[model samples]
Target: MTATCLLPLFETSYVAGEGPDRFYAWPDALILPQKVRGFYVGFLTYTYHKGGFYLLEGWFSWFIVIWTVILLGLMSIGGYFMFRKFLKRLPKEDGMSILDWEEHYINETRHLWDEEQKQLLDELVSPVPELFRDVAKSKIAGKIGELALEEKASKITEDLIIKGYIVATPKRDHKFLIKKLNEKQIDYSRYQSLLAK
Candidate 1:
């Protein structure tokens, strides 16, 4: 565990028609070394005015800020470790296996079809222009169904490939796609071309 220093906080108030007035609180003036016995722990402090401690010691606002910062820092660290573990569990994409057309298709249309018998007929069809902006619009609408289908299926139908509806590639196996993704370092468009046999 690392130590963090928390400094004192100040409070001020101002009237709409008047000027600023500073309210000095005891807790706001105290600073903790943060590290105690090799571990960092935060504690509240009380201040004495002139002679003794009273009911009105310090502003509660400072206490809130100090604890909030500490809480967020711990949460961020936890989140980082959780993500690291998730990355470790996921399968690495290499040449032929890099293509996730089937998974992508399922995810995109999961809500529309039953899990047991999901099919491509549920997807809406639209023409996507070769231009980047047009293709992006088509993708957002989930209209590239034909292309997605061809990317994953082992056997491509002659009618679909001839109509420019699906992408075909020389590399048919999942390993080939994974290998291409890893060894060739090609972009997604390049993958589409490579698959478009």
Candidate 2:
């Protein structure tokens, strides 16, 4: 804790503000000792040590120590709140695993297929062994979700039909063109024309 005297016993000044000059003066100078305690009690004593005239003096005063302590406390509180605000502004981890994110994407797009379409899809993959059909369907659904999320295509039932995952029933007039599932690969040619528009 550092201390500074707050009282100036003698002060002289000249002022010229919108008028003739004005002069002010005080004849005596009060000097405080190099050390004092509890000066903020609002009263303190000093001594006039000028011209070899040693005279004790008393005056009202509030020291700088009190103001310094008050300012430091306010600054500390402000700093704490600022640090908290900075922490809140930082980005937070999402805590979602990749598989969880993929499942969430799948769930969001599941409704794109109508009830009839879903039933047809179920029937299409039914030829796989019962134990493996669910796994195959899940893999297919994951692929579909991936494509949809990439904005390449949304409805994959036609792709599956083209790929022969869904057996095409014979039509009376039109011959169905089917490629075997083993030969299936994602063909973006169909979407290229749509995206060009």
Candidate number with greatest TM-score: 2
lDDT of 1 by residue, 1-197 (tens): 22223333233322222222223334433333345588644443333444322222246635655677889999999899678646544665642222244345535643433432222211212122243333332333232344435475443332222222233222344344344335435344533544555
- Once superposed on the true structure, which residue ranges of model 2 sit more than 4 Å away at CA? 1-102, 152-157, 160-197
Each candidate structure's count of clashing pairs? 21, 0
Q: In model 2, state the lDDT of residue 92.
A: 50
TM per candidate: 0.22, 0.30
> Scored by CA lDDT, what does every candidate get?
0.38, 0.46
Model 2, range 25-125, lDDT digits (tens) per residue?
22333333333374323323222232222222323323344565688899999899678656544555786544455466568777666676566557556
lDDT score, candidate 2: 0.46
Quality of model 1 by C-alpha lDDT? 0.38
In terms of lDDT, the best-performing candidate is 2
lDDT of 2 at 94: 87
